[model samples]
Target: MDEVEVVVAHSERATLRVGDMFLKVDADQARIDAEVAAMALAPVPTPEVLWRKPHVLAMAALPGTTVGRLGGPSTGSPGAWAAAGAAIRKLHDAPLPPWPGPGRRPDELRRELDEECEALVTNGVLPADLVTRNRQVAEAALRPWTPAFTHGDLQIAHVFVEDDEVTGIIDWSEAGRGDALYDLATFTLGHEEHLDDVIAGYGTDVDLAVIQAWWALRSLLVVRWLIEHGFDPFTAGCEVDVLRSRM
Candidate 1:
């Protein structure tokens, strides 16, 4: 037998790769159920569920490299990004999942954003004006959206590519019904240069303003969580840069 490969070992959960299978162990049962349910309904390519228990879910490993890397260039060609965009379009066009959750309600987000901005400013993680400016910019994304099947955390790393095609999308934990542009923003965060490629592949004109707003809003919201988890958002080519870019 081969050694177990620790893919990600965060405080809340950990994923291990063992002999072509991935075992995801999470503490939150609801999140685990959401992941399983979302994967089962997504229209795009996803891992095959091998089995599951209360806290552990096993899935078949996917083939191919990710569409891009975080904080760096993607070795995948523009064609691959386009392919990923097309795949996302397919998913967005699918029927809504039964469990979309409380969702990002504007009132909740406004309050949450205010609190997160205060924390960032109060703790000096980011400058006060930077948070304020980004918060104002984030307002553009607060409008109501027609909910689509959204991969809540659609980073390029979650998309796998082979031969300029999307082999599969992984990490269905955040899958639900939400703003389509939010997923677009999440994927393009810190990688704005590739937005045109992804949009081209999406086969339609999209509202870039909403997507940009999401970039700011999402970055502001996640930095604190990243910090609490012992991750550095200010490191090169990461969330800090994404927030700063808005300034």
Candidate 2:
């Protein structure tokens, strides 16, 4: 018998590993449906769905290790990182999903950012200067963007690689049409050193300022949420550090 291993657990969702299979338990069936649909539509490699039962979806594990984890050193080589970038480019180039997906609209995102920033300061979660400076930096990302198919939460941990080749990208609950730069920023959130390598494989020129702005914006918006979800965004090399780097 395979011992069950808790991959991740929070209020909204949890994932468990039993033998070689991963079981995702989500409170929102719509998110699970979206994830399944996005995986079907994505051009890149994705895990094979073994089965599904209402809120629980079981999937065959993909081969290879995650590119990296936030707050940890990336074990992937430059080639692997470039391969991840190439995979992301393919996903972005794919046709948009019929549904709006999970990314917030610019106006909506602005409101959320402002509210989160105010709370962070008022609740003494972060210093006023830090919040203010990051807010200023984040403003650049609030501008309109032409939408592209995006892995809405393209965190480094979601991308898998083996021998400098991308094998799979997992966790598609947030996949949708959004700013392509946001995906890039999310993938390299704390690993900014790899941006040039990713750009080399992305095979296009992108606005560095916009990417940087997205970093601040993403970090600032998610800090409180992360804390509430039992994630340590304030850890060294994590979201808080990412915001501080902008200051």
Candidate 3:
């Protein structure tokens, strides 16, 4: 993999391309190694290849820029969204090994929401009452479902496409067993206009209200993050618009 000199190396991960191997470094490789192994054992059409050694090397490369960089109308096209849904279905259908990490509990999720909301309120980006109300809604909506393996960060940026089809998914660091709807929620909230397409692609008759609740919760979560980070008011205001529309 050293054939292509290191072009970019972050503190936590490095990107290297040598021949057919595109390697990414993980300070903690055990989880990723397990995830990859699980993918291999399951019947799924994912990226092919493996590690040369733990933290020493890993390899797999597919041709195509991230879907995010290919900013065409196609990014939000029905075909693209359908492809993404199909990809997610494949992942969800894969048999996951028993997860070992501290899973996201309702109380823990609530605590995180409260902390983020409090930070946003303290930063003067949100009203205390609004945060409280959103928190309540989030807690209630999340109560009905049990956790499952979810792609924690399932945004358009993480999707990969080649020859007009989704070929592979990247960034396995956030992969974990969590509320399955959380993945669907992220996809739908970010692509509201394509909700029908996404739902159809998933091939499920999910409750509309539950889906909307998840969408609202995801939007509030993002808005809370942006606000806490002290982003420009314009950015925060745009997030507010998204959050409001869902409610």
Candidate 4:
């Protein structure tokens, strides 16, 4: 019998790997549905869905390692990062998904950020100056944008590659119509060194300022959630460093 390896386990969801199969257990049916639908609609490679039962969805694992992970060195070459960027561009070019993405509403994001910022300052999780500076930087991202098909969480860990070729991207539950830059920003969050390579493959002019703003915005918004979920945002090359870099 194949031993089940826990890939990730948090309050919201847990993923397990048993041999070649990856099983995702999510409590939210809607999120699962969206993941399935997004995978079907995405132009890029995705895990092969085997079966789904209630809150559990089974899939065949893709054959490649992630390009990199936050707070860790990226083992992939520049070409691999560029390939991932090209794949992202393809997804963004595809027709918009039927459902709206979580990033579509900037006002809601502002409110959430405000709350989080207040909590961070009041609780002394981060110094007020750091929070204030990042908030100011984050404001640039809270503006109108032309919606595109987006992988709402395009963290480096979600993109898989082998030998400079993008094999697949995973974790599509947040996929929907949203700002394209958000995806770009998420992809290059901790791996800022690869931004140029990514932009080269993206094959279009990008707003560096907006992308920078997203780095701060995303880091700030997720720090608290990451802590609560047993993730260490303060790791040397992680979210806290990303925010500190803005200082």
TM-score of each: 0.95, 0.97, 0.72, 0.97
* Candidate 1 least-lDDT 10 residues: 99-108
For model 1, the superposed segments whose C-alpha errors exceed 4 Å read: 1-3
lDDT of model 4, residue 52: 93
Q: Model 2: how far is 152 from its true place, Å? A: 0.5
Error of 4 at 42 (Å): 0.5
- Tens digits of per-residue lDDT, candidate 3, 91-158, equal 77665546633346667666777777787789877677666666655665566465555666565655
Clashing pairs in model 4, backbone N/Cα/C closer than 3 A: none
lDDT of each: 0.86, 0.90, 0.60, 0.91
Model 1 scores a TM of 0.95
CA-only RMSD, every prediction: 1.5, 1.2, 4.6, 1.2
What lDDT does model 3 reach? 0.60
Better of 1 and 2 by lDDT: 2
lDDT of 1 at 172: 81
Candidate 4 C-alpha lDDT tens digits along 1-247: 3599887789998888889988999999888988999999999999999999999999998788987788999888989988988999999999998988776488988999999999999999999999999999999999999999999989887888988888888889999999999999999999899999999889899999999999999999889999999999999999999999999
Query: How many clashes show up per model?
Result: 0, 0, 1, 0
lDDT, candidate 1, at 101: 53
